[model samples]
Target: MNINKIKNSKNNFKLIVITAYDALFAKLFEKESHMILVGDSLNMSFAGKPDTLSATLDQMIYHTNAVCTGAPSAFVICDMPFGSYINKDEALRNCIEVYSKTQAAAVKIEGGEDRADIIKHLTSNSIAVMGHIGLMPQYVRSEGGYLVRGKTAEDIEQLVKDAKAIEAAGAFSIVLEGVKTQAAREVTQAVNIPVIGIGAGNVTDGQVLVWSDMLGFFEDFKPKFVKRYLMGGEAVRKAVKQYAQEVQNGIFPSKEEEY
Candidate 1:
């Protein structure tokens, strides 16, 4: 699907975005979700890392390729991992490789005003970009952990400015994460491009959540913004336990089943 469908549906439809790191999940949710992000959260969710700082470009490409292969018709966006895009040249090179190798529709880069130029460069080169602002996980260590942003006047002002800058830089959409509700609302109103919220607020044009978090598959920790739809992890554990019990009781290969 064309990424513009999301950009153009600003007030028409509430876009749905979900994170996926592999082919099976991508295929399963392809029809229900408007977009699938190969988010760097995989560093924590899939790789058992403490933070997103360790996610690599190669890992992102491998996962993005899998998602793209499974959901060919779904719009997929891959995150440009930490240290992969610190400058115009580096950003362009990595983004090009990601787009060329994975066939994802776009790449999401973390940062705000500082990334405007890089966003422009990528867009100009025919590579779509999705901007990420507020509580960037890649900067968690430097920022002193995952604090909610835009709590002060100065913070709100900069957020609005960043949103405008990202829109002007030709990003098709931006992810507003862990920002104050009022500030998130203002940013959504300030940008023509779609704003997808995570912990930001319901005022955004769309919403995104980590797949495992929402499905209760990743039980390591639960963020405040996530809403669990199913106790997937618990269910899996129960199923495994039941299988072991049945095996111990010699319940398998009954008389009617000799092959």
Candidate 2:
């Protein structure tokens, strides 16, 4: 679906968004996912990095291009990494670079009322932006780890305010992450545009998850929010072990496989 359709989907069918870093998985996920995000979470899931803070704009653009190449018809949003949107002018310039270099329909920026000016600048320049709020991965270090938000009345009020500000800044949608369930529901109701959740609960307009986490490719400790649908890592290991056994036993290069 396009941006307009996704925006209009508020209170309608729940949108399905998933992260994809390469062409193969992007194509596989295109049919099921309404939107594919070239998320900076790739730094951890694909690049084996400890956090998302070190992910670069160039890396994001590269993966976005690969995803677009694989799923040409699918709407793709590339993530603007940690330091890429520090200010208005720099944010616009980087966003323009993304637009120029890849087929990404939009770029996601993590922030709220504090980053409204930057979001406004990008949208003003005709760069589509998706807003991200609550438990920002980029703020992990500064905020002292991934803490769930919206526990208090003041926090919930501030979340509503943040959603409104981001909407006012012209973001088509927002990705709300790691918040208390009731708080997520309130924020979703407060916003007219679609609110996509990740670990924030199901009351929102949509949901997103890293492909690796959902598919069970990542064998690391699973988060409470993640529900693995396939034990991909274990299956791969099992198949590889069989293959190794076959090769060692001289049974792999059978008559049927000969050139």
- Top candidate (lDDT): 2
Error of 2 at 101 (Å): 0.5
- In candidate 2, stretches whose alpha carbon ends up further than 4 angstroms from where it belongs are none
Model 2: how far residue 135 lies from native, Å: 0.8
Task: Please give the lDDT score for candidate 1.
Answer: 0.92
- Per-residue C-alpha lDDT of model 2 across residues 1-259, encoded as one tens digit per residue: 9999999899779999999999999999999999999999999999999999999999999999999999999999999999999999999999999999999999999999999999999999999999999889999999999999999999999999999999999999999999999999999999899999999988999999999999899888798999999999999999999999999999998999999
How does candidate 1 fare on TM-score? 0.97
As for candidate 1, its clashing pairs are none
Worst 10 residues of 1 by lDDT: 250-259
lDDT of 1 by residue, 9-95 (tens): 899999999999999999999999999999999999999999999999999999999999999999999999999999999999999
